[model samples]
Target: MIGTPRIQSLPQGIEVGIKALAARCREGEKRIAAALRELEAFGYLQRVRDRLPSGRVITRTIFCNQPTALLRPRRPAPARPQASAPNPASEHTGPSEQPAPEAPAPLPVPPPPPPLPQAPPSVPLPPSLPLVPPPTAPKLPPGPIPRPDELTPELDRAATALLSDLHRRAPQFTLTETDVRQLVPGVAAWLERAAHPDAIRHALTDDPPVPLKRPALLLKHRLTELLPPAPPDTQELAALTHRPRITVTPFQTCEDCDRAFRSPTPGHCRDCREHRAEDLRTAA
Candidate 1:
């Protein structure tokens, strides 16, 4: 009997399955498979197939908790003695000189170990088909749904996948096609507004309902209720756009030194202008 999937409490005699191993290792199925292969190659793990009386085949993966057990070589089993065949002439003379050698009986074999426990059934993912209208917001706080700097086909796909996979975490949120279609717009709205896919998932999945008859409606309701305000950049951009625009004072080129000046028409630059003004003052 495997207790919990925790590594610290792994059952002594019971063999752990891939799922339990994954939980213990804190890894996904692919990583667990790779590690299993390495361990098996290094003699730390072994997989055996067993056929039950019910005609069902199951695979058992055994783990060697104490690796040092492999280092010590096991003593070979003792072989039984075999009796020699008797000659026909010896059989006739038998009673006096032809005493037959005694044969040791065969050793009894032990029965095979019992089959492993069956794995749990896998859950189905929610609908992922394209949204009918993507999703519209009910009434969220105002600002902007700051769009991505470089939008890609990937963002929408990721959002859709996140919504579709929600059922895996919460069984109550088994979204149908119509639900996905309806809720997708709200998710899209969140993503466009710079919300992370994970954040969106958390907001929608946090504290799931017990007897959820309509997942889409609840999600739709959350779409507006839990909707976050516009991101910082959007706020900054709004601030900038709302500010007054400044007008520029055009400059003209000086006829004397090719220098630019802010005047209707200047014969020279500031130095020349000051010089002319000083000379005119002296002459007066």
Candidate 2:
């Protein structure tokens, strides 16, 4: 059995049994069992289950000089795998120790979260402003006034004279030079409308409002609101075309009867006035 080609050529993982061993040794089962018991007692053999590369488990009979050496777990073969038959004359090296695993990388540390935004500071409010009184209004709406350039110097002088006489006409309408200057424009505009000087004075002084505050503003409102309409176009054209002549004659003492009368020339009475030739014939 030791030098047989069949036993040598057989695969590594054959089934384990005492019958096959007894057959090979030409002994009965009882004698083989006795031999196996003696081998176990002497620590030269051990039977254990082993796994094959094909994932099959089978009982294997192991022979060793020292059974304690076989107790250490053996890693899988590196150079030659157990799946195929090993070469008969090949020299096998010892199993190498396993390499240690490298330490795992340290866990990364996250940066601190961004600082929370700060709130804005509060501000105080300013004090409220005081209320003001509104200016007083007149009884009428003063329309647009004539420009200073539009008023003639003579008309301005006449307006000033007429406004100056208001105090004499009505005792309450006393005014200052500044007030008169400011009102001259409105009065001159009235004169432009052909309003007589006496008529303007009468209209202003006739019914003066009691407790008059600003005389200039009052007069301005009256002049604008109560302005007269322009003269008729025919009369204006006739006056423009043929200027009318007015002769002023003053009354005087008559040399004959010492009576007063109207005459174109000074120093004359009613009978002293020259009569036309038609008047003499009518008298005859």
Candidate 3:
């Protein structure tokens, strides 16, 4: 099994149990089991039994890179030799044959030395000086705080603009208010992380490596994948005091086509004006 190319090509992290291999190869469990048994008999597969600290036994299957011809059974250890006892006849004869032993001579004692004179007492040392405290660091001046309106509505506007742009560019996706609400948090997170709106738009609109069945799901995935850098610190935000604002243009209905358009003249749209000019030229 280890020598098989198909098994070799499998990822290390992938599960390679009998059932998993069977599913991957589109084979029956019985067939896989039989194949495993054959491999075991051929010494290509080995089972190792482990005793866990919890007293539970577990068996693991190992794939041998090189198969063995035969497996030798473990041999038992040799028995240890016991100590021999003393003979009773030798103990009985020892007292009658041996003579009494003589006592050892006493050792000579040495004389003690005379005591020496005592030394004078030592003088006391002076106490240490007290330690001086360290100087405190200078405080920094407070930075300019942002206006309440400016701080509160940035995330909201960014989210709204992102969703609106997505709808305008991909009308076929048919994004609803519910979807917009659900996707707002993600957009706001990008905005909070200091990502530009154009960057977010590009990330969402870029062609993915694989075809997408669900636009919402793909968008969510891209949002996570293309996460922007973290939000700038207070000092950086203070440096960026001004932000660009969007201006809304009012629309009026064209008299000829009844279509709404932004025009200073307010009488007709570009299309209606073009058509009127063409009509006059044809008549002339």
Give the winner by lDDT: 1 or 3: 1
The residue ranges of model 1 lying beyond 4 angstroms of the native Cα positions read 1-153, 234-284
Candidate 3 lDDT over residue span 1-284, tens digit each: 32346665787546556877878886778877777777778765655554443556766565543454224332333333444576666676345554344332222111222345578776777877447534564545532211122334768777867876785776544466777766677787777776788888888877654444567766666666666667678887877875666776679899988999986557899899999999999999
Backbone Cα, N, C clashes tallied per candidate: 2, 0, 0
Which model, 1 or 2, shows the larger TM-score?
2
Stretches of candidate 2 above 4 Å error? 1-142, 146-149, 234-284
**Per-residue error at 103 for model 2, in Å?**
99
Q: Rank the candidates by lDDT, best first.
A: 2, 1, 3
Winning model by TM-score: 2
Off by over 4 Å in 3: 1-151, 209-211, 234-284
Give all candidates' CA lDDT scores. Answer: 0.66, 0.66, 0.64
Candidate 2: C-alpha RMSD to true structure equals 43.7
TM values, all candidates = 0.30, 0.32, 0.28
